[model samples]
Structure formats: C-alpha cells, structure tokens
Target chain A: MKKTPLNQVHRELGARMVDFGGWDMPVQYSGVIEEHLAVRQAAGLFDVSHMGEVEVRGANALAFIQQLTINDAAKLVDGQVQYSAICYPEGGVVDDVTLYRFNGAHFLFCVNASNIEKDFAWMQQVLRESALTDVTLTNRSAEFAQIALQGPKSVAILAELTDVSLDDLAYYHFCEGAVAGEQMIISRTGYTGEAGFELYLPASAAVAVWQKLMAAGAPHGLLPIGLGARDTLRLEKGYALYGHELSRDISPLEAGLAWITKLDKDDFVGKAALVAQKAAGVPRRRVGLVMEERGIPREGYPLFAGEREVGFVTSGTMSPTLKLGIALALVEPAAAGLDGELEVAVRNRRMRARVVRPPFVK
Target chain B: MEFPEELKYTEEHEWVMVEEDLAVVGITDFAQDALGDVVFVELPEVGTVVEAGKAFGVVESVKAVSDIYAPVSGTIEEINDDLVDAPEIINTSPYEDGWMIKIRMADAADVDDLMDVEAYQALIAEES
Candidate 1:
C-alpha cells in the first residue's frame, strides 16, 4: 500500500488507518461522528495528499484539455478551477477531475487517487493520437502534498498561518502563496461542502505545514479529519465520489453532472454520445434517499419501486449530521421523483425509503 | 479501556454479567473503541430465541456495521430501548447504559465457558 507524507503523523495521532484505494490512509482519528460534527460546527483538517496531480503544459495545453475533458476548459481563466470529467467515447465517465488553469499554456489536473495511473495513461494515449506537438504531459502525483482545512472556522484558522489575504480568494480560485514559510498553492475549494481551502505544497514540507496549521487551529477546536468523515461530509452535499457516483459505465449526465458536461463544446471526447443520450433522455438518474425505516442502506443494496427492482445504492451511510440513514442511489428516472417511496433491500429484508433531494442535511 | 472484573467475556468482544438465571449482555470498551461512534443499532425483540455463538443483532457505526454475537443460548427477556435513539451512548458508556439485551439463560454453565475479566484482558493484549 502507498503511504502519504503524513502517514506517520496520522499514526502518531492515534488515527485508525485503512487501505483506501491501495493507499494507507487514516479512516478516523478521534471518531467518525465527532470528527464529522467538528467539521460541520467548527473546523477540521484533512490529509488529502493521496489525490493525484497531472500537469499539462505547452502551447497546446488549452486546446489539449478542451478536447480531452467534458467541461469547457477554454472558459477557465488563470487561477480558476473547474470541476470536470474525462469520458470514454461511449459517454461513460473515465474519471472526474478538477482542472486548475494557470494559463493557456499550463494546466493542472487533480484526479482521484484510484484513477491516477489509468487517467495518466489515457491522457498520454489521447495526446499521442491527437498529434499535439506542443503539448507536454507530466504525472506529478508524488511531488505534492495536499491538506484541506474545512468548516465555518476554516478561514479564520488558515488566516493565522499565512500572510495571503484569504478574503480575496473567491470560491474555486487559487493563488500561489507562502504558508508556514513554505511555498504552496492555496485553493478555495474542497470536497466537503464548507468554507475551506486546499493547500498544496512540496511533499518534504508537509509535516511542518501540518504542524503549523494544527497549532494555529487548535484554539478553535480544529480536529484532524479522516476519510470516514470525509465521505459523509461530501455525501451530505450530494457530491459524486469517483467510483460510487461516477464510474466506467456511468455517464456524467446520469450522475447529476450535466451542468459540468458541456455538450456545446466543440468535439470533446464523448460529445456525440452525450448529445445522443441527452436527446434520448437518460434511463437512470441519481437520487438521494432517506431511510424511513431503521436499517442502514449500504452500497450495492437493491432498490425497488413497488415490486420491480429499479436500481441499487451507490453510497449509503447513517448520516452523522442528519441522524438518518441516507443514501445515493441510481434508479430508473421514473422512480427518481422527489418524495417518492422506495424500498431498499437491507440485510435481505425490504426497508422503506423516501426519495429526497440532496443535500440531505441542509 | 475498562473491563469490569465481575463480567465474563466472549472472544467476539461481548460482555456478559451473570445474574442468577439471567445475564445482561453488552459490548466491551475495546469493542466500542474499535467500532467508533455507534450511529444505529438493530436489536432483537424480547422473547426472541438466540443461540450461543450466533449473531443476535447489529451495531452500526459511521464507517462500518458489526454483528453482536450471542454469548450464551437463551430467550431475550429485555432489551435496552434507549440505544435506538442515541446509539452513541455505546461509545460513552459501553458497559452500563449501552447494555444491549438481557437473556434468560438456557444453561447457567455457559457462563463458565466464557473468559473472566483477567482472561479477557489477556485476549485483548494478545490480539493487539
């Protein structure tokens, strides 16, 4: 298993470690609910170093990315970020990524850890096929260490550590700054639906930066968050996890990402298929479900509308914030209506569930 | 971290307090610590028959769901209804308020087959 730069720090903090997508990551430190609540009410810090970063640079960077990703990368200005996905020719998702545009000639793609190798290889192959002479692709996954400081108190905690005016950093925007005396890319973006910043620094400077942030955040009760709470926080906001909500066989439109999939963009991968699918209408739609019964719905649990099996849950949990059994399921479009009643087969018995719009907590 | 000296323990991490012909059952502190923030619990109804070494109910945390095993064969006489609303009490007070069920023991001798506090501590130490 691959260990992040903060692996020892997590172990020292008494975090429960788990194998997450072949990476040794902390699943929880204090506890899932407590850490989750801390992020909701106060603030939480997270080690997100395991996520992959790929740099696409050169004269054709904008053109290359625009053709490679589903979103209109040409719309992104320097220092701006766009949530986008790479799709196969058939319209199924390859991976959802965050495109960080430094300039027309330099772009950074932050992808999921599990899809690093696959996405990198795919990009290389596509670039080779496109015959883009000026473009250069580099997988810089191991060179960076990233941390997310998230919550209502996130800005205040981060403000104590850096001279950068965080007030000026708009959402989905980034700036190069010095934090804890180390050069880092501070981005006002996070998976958790909170006012947060993701700081990307050199791998060797991770420990010092983490300690400085921890010290600064301690007075405000900033707990070190782990993957367990991270999952719940994102799910509460209806954020799509790569493997669960978006997959090789799942189209972005079906995954509630139609807004990001720009069909009007000229000749991107999967454009034709997505256009056809949009015209035909998607067969399945992702919907939020709150369990009416006591059972916790789990991934792969079958969903039924009346007696007909409609779909299966993609991600489900006993929501720490809502105190309810909430889940995300991809069901037949007809069964995805709000307030519609559905049954989830949990532990072999059908449990009552109601279709509701996410974010489940808010 | 605490293991009551009077209670007997199962290898699966359940604690049983033998009281005459009945036994009050709950998970151990070590078990609760490992489970992390119990969010939901599914308990068997009173009068439900449970067999020794078989799963009787489930204890769910935010990250994982675990089965609570029956330490001794018996019929459930009572259950801790308080756990259904605030399952987190299992993390705060695993041995006392978090007790899952009380069973009318089918055989009093089954308690002897289980490990005492000292033996249970040794078991935990060996695993760690």
Candidate 2:
C-alpha cells in the first residue's frame, strides 16, 4: 500500500485508515459524520496526494492536448483549468481530467488515480500520431503531494501561510506562490461543494505545510477530514467519480457531462463521434433517485419499475444533509427522461424511489 | 478497543451481557470503531429466531456495509427501537445504549462457546 506524506499525521490524529484505490488513505478522523458536518459548516483539510498528476511539457503541448481530449484546449487561458473527458474512439470516456494550462508549453492533466497509466499511454499514442513536435509526458504522481483546504473558512486558514492573494483567484484558477518558504501551486478548486484551495507541492514541502496549516487552523475548527467525508461531500454535489459514475464504457453525453464537450473545436479525438451522437441524440442518461421508503440504496443494486429491471445504481448513499437515501443511476433514455417512481433492490427488499435531477443532497 | 470486563464476547466482536435467561446483545467498541460512523442499521425484528454465528443485522457506514453476527442462538425478544432514528448511538455508546437486541437463549450451554474478558482481549489482539 502506498502512503502519502501525511500518513503519520493521519495516524497521530487517530484516523481510521482504509485502502483507497492502491493508496492507504484515511477514511475518517474523528468520524465521517463529524468531519462531513465540519466541512459543510466550517472548514476541513484533506490529503489528496493520491490523485494522479501527469505533466505534459513541450512546444506542441497545447496542440497535443486539444487533439487528445473532447474539450477545447484552445479555450483555456494560462493559469486556468478546464474539466474535460478523454474518450475512446467510439466516444466512450476513458477518464475525466482537469487540464491545468500552467503556461503555453507546460500543461498538467490531473486525472483519477486509477486511470493514470491508461490515460498516460493513451496521450502518448495520440501524440505520436500527430505532427505536434517534441511533446514529453511525465508521471509525477509519486513526487508530489496535494492538499485541499475546503469550506467557508478556507481562505482565512490558507492566507496565513501563502503569499498568494487567494481572494483574487477565481474558481478553477491556479497560480504559483510560496508557502512557508516552499514554492507551490494553489488552485481555487475542490471536490467538496464548498469554496476552497487545493495546494500542490513536492512531498517534502507538503509535510511541513500540512503541519503548519493544521496548527494554524485548529482554533478555527478546521478538521482533518478523510475519504469518507470526501465521498459524501462530493456526492452531495453530484460530481462524477471515475469508477463510480464514470467508466470506459460510458460517454460524456450520457453521463451528464455534455457541457464539457466542444464540438466546434478544430478536430479533436472523439469529437466527430460525439458530434454524430449529438446529431442522433444520447441513448441512456444519468439521473438521481431519492428513496421514498426506509432503506438506503447502494451501488450495483438493480433498479426496478415494479417487476421490470430498468437499470442499475451506479453510486448511492444515505445523504447526511437530506437524511434520506439518494443514488445516481444509468437507465434507458425513456426511463431516465421521464418522471416516475422506481424501486431499488436493497438487501432483500425493494425501496421505493423517485427519479429526479442530480446533486441529491444539495 | 474497549472490552468490558463484565460482558462476554464473541470472536466476531459482539458483546453479550447475560441476565437470567435473557442476553443483551450489542457490538463491541472494536466493532463499532472498525465500522466508522453508523448511518443505518438493519436489526432483527422481535420474536425472530437467530442462529449462533449467523448474520442478524447489517451495519451501514459511509464506506461500506458490515454484517453483525449473533453470538449465541436464540429468539430475539426485543429490538432497540432508538437506533432506527439515530444510528450514531452505536458509535457513541456501542456497549450500553446501542444494545441491539435482547434474546432468549435456546440452550444455556451455548454461552460456553464465547470468551471471557481476558480471552476476548487476547483474541482481538491476535486478529489485529
């Protein structure tokens, strides 16, 4: 199991550890509910170094990225980040990535940890086919650590350590700055449905920054949260995780990520296929469900409309804020498009639910 | 992992406090801690027969769902109704207020299969 720079710090705080992908990460510190509520009401810190970072640097980096992803890379200004999906030739998503346009030549694609190798290889193969010159792809996941300080109180806590004026940095924007004498990239972005900053730095520098932030944010009720809260927080906002709501077999249009696809962009991979799909229309759609009955729905559970199997639950959980079971499911266009009652087979019983718009907890 | 000296334990991390022919069953501190924040718990209904070492309840957390096994075979005489509304009690007080069910023993000799305080502690340590 891989350990992050904050592994010992998590242990010292009595965090419950679990295997997240291949990394040994904390599931919770005080508890999931407590840490979750802390992030909603105040602030929370997270060790998100397990997320994979791939650096692409060369003269043709921008042109190369534009050809590989479904989103328009030309639309991104330097110091800005754009959410896009790398799709297979058939228009199915390989992985959802956040393209950080650090500069004209230097770019970084922050992808899901599990899809690092696959995306890296895909980009390399695609780059070789293009006339884009001197493109270099490097996986720097092991060398760096990323921490997210999230919630309404994030700016107050981060401002004390970093020289960067976080107030001016808009959402999805990043800039280089110094924190406790360590150079860092701070992005005003996060998975949680709250305002926060994601700090990216070398592993050694991250340890010191984490300790300093923890000590400084203690009086402000900044809890050191874990993946347990991270899931609940992101689920509340209906963010699609790579393996859960997203997969190699699903397309961005069907996954409710059509906003990120740019069809008008100068030819890109999967663009023609996606443009064809848009002309024809999507087949299946992702929708949210709220259990009208007692039981909480879970992933891989079969969805029923009375006795008929209509779809499968992709991701489901008991929403802490709503105090009800909610899930994201993929179903036929007719079944998902229409407003109707559905049932999820939970344990041995059927839970009555209603199909609604996503971001269930929100 | 706090194991009460007065309670008998199973290797599955369940604690049973025997009072006359009735046994008050609940999960141990180790079990609760391992399960994390309890979001929902599916408990056995009253008067339902349960077998020793069989799953009688489901403990749902944010990460995963875990099965709560019965220590000794018996009929569930009463179920803790409070947990349906507030399952977090299992995290706060697993051995006390979070007592899941009360069972009437089918055979008194079945308690012998369980471990005492010192033995249960040793068993937990071995597994850890």
Candidate 3:
C-alpha cells in the first residue's frame, strides 16, 4: 500500500486508517460526521497527495490534448483549468480529468488515483499516434504533495501563507506563487463543492506546510480531515467519483457531463459519437434519488419502477446534512422524469425514493 | 477498551450485562471504534425470540453495515429506541445508555460460552 507524505501526521492526529484505492490513508480523524460537518460549517484540511498529476508538454501540446480529450483544449486560457473526459474510440469514458493550461506548450492533467496507470498508458499510446514533437509525458505525482484547505474560512487561512492575494483568483482559476518560502501552485478548485484551495508543492515540504497550516488555522477550527468525510462531503455536493459515478461502460453524455464535452471543437476521440448522442438525446442518464422510507440505500442496490427493475444505484449513502438516504442511479430516460418517485431495494426492503436532480443533499 | 468484570462478551464484540434474570446487550467500545460512526441501527422487535450466537440486529456505519449478534438466547423485552434517531450514542457510550436490547434469558447455561473481561481482552490483543 502507498502512504502519503502526511501519513505520520494523520496517525498522530488519531485518524482512523483504511485502504483507499491502494493508499493507506486516513478515513477519519475525529469522526466522519464531525469532520464532514466541519467542512460545511467551518474549515477542514485534507492531504490529497494520492491524486495523480501527469505533465504533458511539447511543441504540439495543444494539438495532442485536443486529439486526446473529448473537450476542446484550445479554448482554455493559460492560467485556467477545464474539466474534460478522455474516452476510448467506442465512446466509453476512460477517465475524467482536469486539463490545466500552464502555457502554450505545456499542460498538466490531474486524474483519479485508481486510473493512473491505465490513463497514463492510454495517453502514451494516443500521444504516439500524433506528430507532436518530443511529447514529454512525465508522472510527477509522487514527487509533489497536495493539500486541500476547504470551507468558508479556507481563503483566510491560506491568505496568511502566500504573498499572492487570493482575492483575484476566481473559481476554477490557479496561481503559481510561493507559500512559506516554498514554491506552490494554488488552485481554487475543490471536490467538496465548497470555497477552498488545493495547494501543490514538493513532497519534501509537505509535512512542514501541513504543520504550519494546522497551527495557524487551529483557532479558527481547521481539522485534519480524512477520506471518510471526503466521500460524504463530495456526495453531498453531487460530485462524480471515478469508480462510482463513472466507468468504462459509462459515457460522458450519459453521466450528465456534456457541458465538459465540446463536440463543436475540431476533431477529438469519441467526439463524433458524443455529438451524435447529444443531438439524438441520450437514452439513459444518471440521476439522484432520495429515499422517503426508513432504510439507507447503498451502492449496487436495485431500483424499481413499480414491479420491474428500472436501474441500479451507482453510489448511495445516508446524507448527514439531510438526514435521509440518497443515491445516484443510472436509469432509462423515460423513467428519470422529475415528476414522480421510484422504489429502491435496500436489502430485503424497498424504500420509496423521488427522482431528483444530481445533488440530493445540495 | 473498557471491559466490565461482571459482563460477558461475544466473539463478535457484543457485551451482555446481567441484571437479575434479564441481560442488557450492546456492542463493545472496540467494535464501535472499529466501525467508526454508527449511522443507523436496526433493532429486533420487543417480543422477538433470538437464538444464542445468532444475529438479532444490524448496525450501519458510513462505510459498511454489520450484523449485531445475540450473546445468549432469549426474548427481547426492551430496546433503546433513542438509537434510531441518534446512532452516534453507540460510539459515545456503547456499554451504558447505548445498550441495544434487554433480553430475558431462556437458559443461563448459554452465558458460560461467553468470555469474561480477561478472556475478551486477551482475545482482542491476539486479533490486533
């Protein structure tokens, strides 16, 4: 199992450790509920170095990215990032990644940890097909450490560390600056659907920055959070995870990620099919369902419209904020209307659930 | 980690406290700690009869769900209904107010199979 740079710090804080996608990471520090509530009300710190960062830089970097991703990379500004879906030729999603336009000739793709090896290999194979010169693909994931300070007070805590004013950095924007004399890239992007910043720096300087943030932000109630709360928090905000909300069989259009898919852009992998799907309207879509009965719905549980099984849950959990069971399920578009409810089978019992939008808790 | 000397423990980490002829049962602190936060509790009905070493209830946490086994065979007399609304009490006080059910023991001989404080501690140490 892999351990992050802040593994020792997590242990010292009495975090409950669990194996998360082969990384021996903290599942919780105080508790899932408390840590989750803290991020919603105050601020929480997360060691997210487990996410993979791959650098793709060459003279034809823009051309390579345009061909490799389903979204148009040419539209992104130098300091901005765009969320895109990379796909196989058969129109199935390989991975959902954030394409950061560092410069004209350079870009960084932040991908899910579990899909790192597979995504890297796929990108390399695709890179080989293009005429991009010296398309230097480097995996600097292990060399850099990332910390996400999230919630309402995150900007205040991070503002004290860096000289660059965070006031100018809008949502989804990033700035390269120095924090505590160490070089860092601070992005205003987060998975928890809260105001926050993801700071990336050298692995050697990770622990020191963590300690500095904890000490400086302790008075404002910044807790060292874990993956358990991370899951619940993201679920509340309706964020899609790699294995749960996405898979090799799921397409970006079916997953409600068509906003990221720019079919109008010049040629890209799976663009033709995606544009066709968009034009024809996708038959199956991912939607949110909230249980009205007394049972907690879980992943892989069957969803029924009357007697016949219409769909199955991809990700489901009891919402801490709403005090109700909610799930994301892929159902036939005809059965996914906002006008009615469905039944979700939890174990032997079936619970009444309403088909809402993507975010049930939000 | 607290193990009352008079209480009996099951291998599944449930503890039974005998008061007269009735036994009040709940999961151990070690079990609650391992399970993290308890989100939902499915308690057996008040009049349901359960067999020794069999599941009588279920405890669902944020990540997974686990069956709560009966330490001894008996009819459930009472249950702590407060856990239905606030299951975190199990993590805060697993041995006391968080007691899951009260059962009238059908046979005292079933208690002999359970572990005492020392035996349970040793069992946990070995597993850890």
Using lDDT as the measure, which candidate wins? 1
User: Which candidate's TM-score is highest?
Assistant: 1
CA lDDT of each prediction against the hidden true structure: 0.94, 0.88, 0.88
Model 1, residue A146: distance off in Å is 0.3
Tens-place lDDT digits, model 1, residues A1-362: 99999999999999999999999999999988889999999999999999999999999988889889999998899999999999999999999999999988999999999999999999998899888889999999999999999999999998988899999999999999999899999999998899999998999999999999999999999999999999999989989999999998999999999999999878988999999999999989999999998878989999998899999999999888878899999999999999999999988589999999899977
True-vs-predicted CA distance for residue A353, candidate 2, Å: 1.6
Chain A of model 3, TM-score against the native?
0.97
Q: Give the TM-score of candidate 1.
A: 0.97
Ranking by DockQ: 1, 3, 2
Off by over 4 Å in 1: none
Off by over 4 Å in 3: A276-281
Error of 3 at B112 (Å): 1.0
Clashing residue pairs found in predicted model 2: none
**Candidate 2, which CAPRI tier?**
medium
